[model samples]
Target: MGNLKGVALSLLFTSFVLHLPFAESDWFINYHIHVTNDLPLLKSPPNQPNLFLHCKSKNKDLGERGMVKGQDYTWDTKVNFLRTTLFFCKARWVGHKTRSFDAFVTDRDEMPCRHYHNSCMWSVRDDGIYFSKNNATWGNVYPW
Candidate 1:
């Protein structure tokens, strides 16, 4: 009985430590097979204010794979390769400081908007669009 208790304690501690950093981070990557269609909100004015992008994948198992914080909205950055078109609502005009926007990744063959439904919500910030130098319209998002 004593040995079993020790093993359980160790497992619990290990899990907690592993997820600590991820919980505190601001963003994560999406590698699911359900989201394929991208919904764009609004494009930045020609070249005025700085642009930013935030994405989230409902599939917690897939895990994030790129920059999770301090995004400056650069066109030649590495995030443009994800190829997942994001959906933005009217409220996305808020900015990237707030933690309101989120996204999920899926393939063309899987359910496109099954997780988020026909409409996507915003948290009063521009934290929903996937910042890239490619197309301006959010249509079908492809994986990097």
Candidate 2:
């Protein structure tokens, strides 16, 4: 019983440490996803967190990692500000208002969707930001 208790305590400690948000790493956006097909040269907005993934459809998938529409995105790991673009558009037709917005992903276990079985895992490296998909598993970050 004592051995089991010790093992449990160690596991709990390890889990807690892993879940703790680490210091943001050095990362930046090299490019951005265009909000529309005709938006000439969509650059990353200035002075705001960059978006990682974006979509327009009510039911969308931002890679298998996460999804974003309007202003909601998932940041399940460390993210570099001024980098990454998650441009979302609500309309494909010309002259239509697009519910678009972008923001950097900096949190974990974020579910962009409330009814879907997807989760986000953000990571940072020399290149830029990267995210992965987990059905429910979290606390995992990856580099793009």
Over 4 Å off in model 1, which ranges? 1-46, 56-99, 105-110, 113-144
What lDDT would each prediction earn against the true structure? 0.31, 0.33
Q: Which candidate has the highest TM-score of all? A: 2
lDDT of 2 by residue, 1-144 (tens): 999999999999889766655423223212222221212222443323233334432233555222222333333322344223243322221222323332223232223422234333333222333333432432212212
Candidate 1: C-alpha RMSD after superposition: 13.9
Q: Which ten residues in a row have the lowest lDDT in candidate 2?
A: 33-42
Cα TM-score per model: 0.19, 0.20
